[model samples]
Target: MNTQNAEMDVESLQKRRRGCFLDAFLVGSVMFLFAAVTTLAVVGVMTVKDVESRLKPPSWTSESGPLKLTDVSSSAVFTNFAYLEATTSGLKNATMQWAVQQTSVGHNFQYDRTNHWMMPVQSGNYFMYVNLNFTCTHICPSGDFTIHVGEGVVDKLSCKVHLPKLQDSTAVIKKCWTVSSVASKQKLISHMTVPKEGLDNWSLDMGLGMFLVD
Candidate 1:
């Protein structure tokens, strides 16, 4: 009888041990599944963000447009000047306007019309840069412009402008003198003073210098 009782106790203990092991294995499997699910969720979110970025245009590109520079110089001593204009092409549903001023010097300036602008004219050469943002509601118009400057030594002026296109992050830099148009979007306009020596060599890619816009 004693032997029987002992055998029964041993069997019970063995059964309990097996049950514990099975429970532990089930818990481990559940934990592994949870971890896998979490990892997949994170990857999915990252993929969505990447897709969004790919769909959106870059800031520099989205904020630029067709750029033109007009040299208005008189045959006088240190009385040459220039102005810049940027227009939108194909961009629809946007209102576009821009203003430029010499950050270093003061001068009279105008936009959209003539005879209603003023700025303090300062000595020495200066750069008047403009930035524009707009949204059109009706028809998109081709970008066009004229830059005006007071009588001064209008040395060489360089323009660096970019316009962004939808579905791409990179901006298309309107090659200097090459005309570009946008029908509906924001555009960027930048003007800088060109060095006298660099202006002499128009063929070299100064990356930013004067070029004739035909």
Candidate 2:
């Protein structure tokens, strides 16, 4: 009976030793896996930082920074006028004419057409267009029609349309100008031109249009 007890005790000791070894192996494997994951995470962060440092402007940045420029702040406004009667007789060169009426569509914009000079009140980029149509007694000589815009006498922008030789019919002149970097307080005015003979019949459809852009 004493020998039998000794053998059972030896078997129990061997089983405990095997269990301890298995536990140690499992713990070591878990530790190694955790270390590898941590190293990979650190290397990935460093690589991203290095790539960001070498980047240049005009590219997207992931780091928290000022939002890139956008056109959301841009705005547009414009006003125009037209004449119902002939404002001038024998018109050959540039001249400013006031409108007796204003178009209802453009009154709410930035343009303030007190009379002939429908100038802009807000300062920004603006697109200005003018169309002057007329009638004549005889065939009118082909000439250039110009829309002159500026402060006082300095013509900053001029849009011109050529009138081919046509008489006893209709003559049309048009001009368009895209102005940039303008001051709000700067004095602005505009004028138009047509053939001398066509001036008497230049009574209808004489209109101007403008739009402001950011």
For residues 86-183, could you state the per-residue lDDT of candidate 1 as single tens digits?
Answer: 33232222222223221111122223323222232323323332232323323322232222222233312223332222332222323322222211
Candidate 1 TM-score over all chains jointly: 0.31
Highest TM-score model number: 2
Task: Per model, state how many residue pairs clash.
Answer: 31, 1
**Candidate 2 lDDT over residue span 67-184, tens digit each:** 2222111212213211122255455555565443323223323334344454445577655544555555465666666667777777656777666666566645443445545556
Lowest summed-lDDT stretch of 10 residues in model 1? 201-210
lDDT of 2 at 157: 68
Worst 10 contiguous positions by lDDT, candidate 2: 69-78
Candidate 2 residue-wise lDDT at 161: 68
- Model 2 ranges off by over 4 Å: 1-90, 104-115, 170-175, 193-204
All candidates' lDDT scores? 0.33, 0.52
Model 2 accuracy (lDDT, Cα): 0.52
